[model samples]
Target: MNNKTRQFFVAALMAASLGTVIAAQAAGAVESLRGRDVETQSREPGKYATEKDGPPIERNYVQQPPLIPHKIDGYSITTNFNKCMDCHSWTRYRETGATKVSLTHFKDRDGKELSNISPRRYFCNQCHVPQTDAKPLVENTFKKAEGLR
Candidate 1:
């Protein structure tokens, strides 16, 4: 109730909070995968060491965006210049043999079709990721659609 008593109570509360945090850390309650002991495990293996030189993989589910089959190093996807359009745009697909940008990419959020790739879908990397042979960080037991197999 008095100033001295109130100050003492606040100090005790602060000390108790600090003690709880220190105790949790000592007990390994905040362990992180990246913070594991180096002696117990080596650094995570680098990205898939080799790029596959085969056909694009089949999609496991409906509406799945196809994966990029080739390297996109140095490609730029800036608003002023989308390098992917050089090969994947509708006008260029026929000559370049690159897959055409999907019609869906031309649709606005309200479903009205536009003349070009939608602003929201302009970045190819947002949904379509390049396939890498990287080892899984965790086991994947996902099952494909029945007809896909």
Candidate 2:
């Protein structure tokens, strides 16, 4: 190999070894499966407000699914059971004051109608998400569609 290429590789190896040694000495940190020091890339979770039950947030676009207006931190949704259906199901929403599940949720991928929520749409979190009182992590120029205004 040329002298410059050989020197670059040697320098890179030295830097990597030095980082590993320093990390080990500093915190007894372990190397990840990818050979990175685990402590080198870590951050605490961001704080967010505990959202309260409220009216549904307005959608910014035509096809946007409605956002959950309440916190669902402990709600359970498994293959055999869905806690969301307890209140949002057609039979219960009216009595519970919760919005009814959309009619579209009852259709299969092939557009065939079903008697119950389709398996593909049973997991509400896949499309519906709750909003939090957190500041935007970055600035953006996003605007609602003109028709929505």
Candidate 3:
């Protein structure tokens, strides 16, 4: 209502508006590791060599989830159906020549064992990726544990 009060409020509002604009511009300048705007949809998958069906790759460390050795393109792994189970299920692995789903996969988060793959462990690709020809985004010098070597 007073001149000084009105002037102070106006100055504060303009400063806040300027701050917001600067922040938005800064955000837009940042690119994600995938080399795209953070908010954008991921780029289309790139062409990578699909590894042929083979024996399981050796683990680099204890307790590492095994890397998938075969191409799994078009595999369906939904809540109701898991294409992987057709070959990797305990009942089918022997005949299919696919590695059986790990025994650990049957344990609940609470450590109780179930008769089938626990829901928490049902999505295989969540932790396991098929080995491909794609290079790492960053360089690393990691090595296998001495025991594994």
- For each candidate, what TM-score against the reference? 0.67, 0.69, 0.66
Alpha-carbon error at 38 in model 3, in Å?
23
Regions of candidate 1 where Cα sits further than 4 Å from its true position: 1-46, 50-53
lDDT of 2 by residue, 35-96 (tens): 43222332323334545778777899889888888877788999998999999999999999
Q: Model 1, residue 118: displacement in angstroms?
A: 0.4
Residue range with the least summed lDDT across 10 consecutive positions in model 1: 34-43
Q: Give candidate 3 regions above 4 Å deviation.
A: 1-47
Relative to the true structure, candidate 1 has a C-alpha RMSD (angstroms) of 6.9
User: Over the stretch 1-149, how does candidate 1's per-residue lDDT look in tens digits?
Assistant: 99999999999999999999999999978665434432333335632432444578789998899988876767899989999999999889999888999899999999999998899999999998776565777999989998787
Q: How many backbone clashes does candidate 3 have?
A: 0
lDDT of 3 by residue, 38-141 (tens): 23333345324545677677899998999999877789999999999999999999999888998999999899999989999999999998765555656889
Local distance difference test values of all predictions, in order: 0.80, 0.81, 0.81
Error of model 2, residue 2, in angstroms: 26
Q: Superpose all Cα atoms of candidate 3 onto the true structure and report the RMSD in Å to 1 decimal.
A: 7.4
Model 1 TM-score relative to the real fold: 0.67
Q: TM-score ranking from best to worst?
A: 2, 1, 3
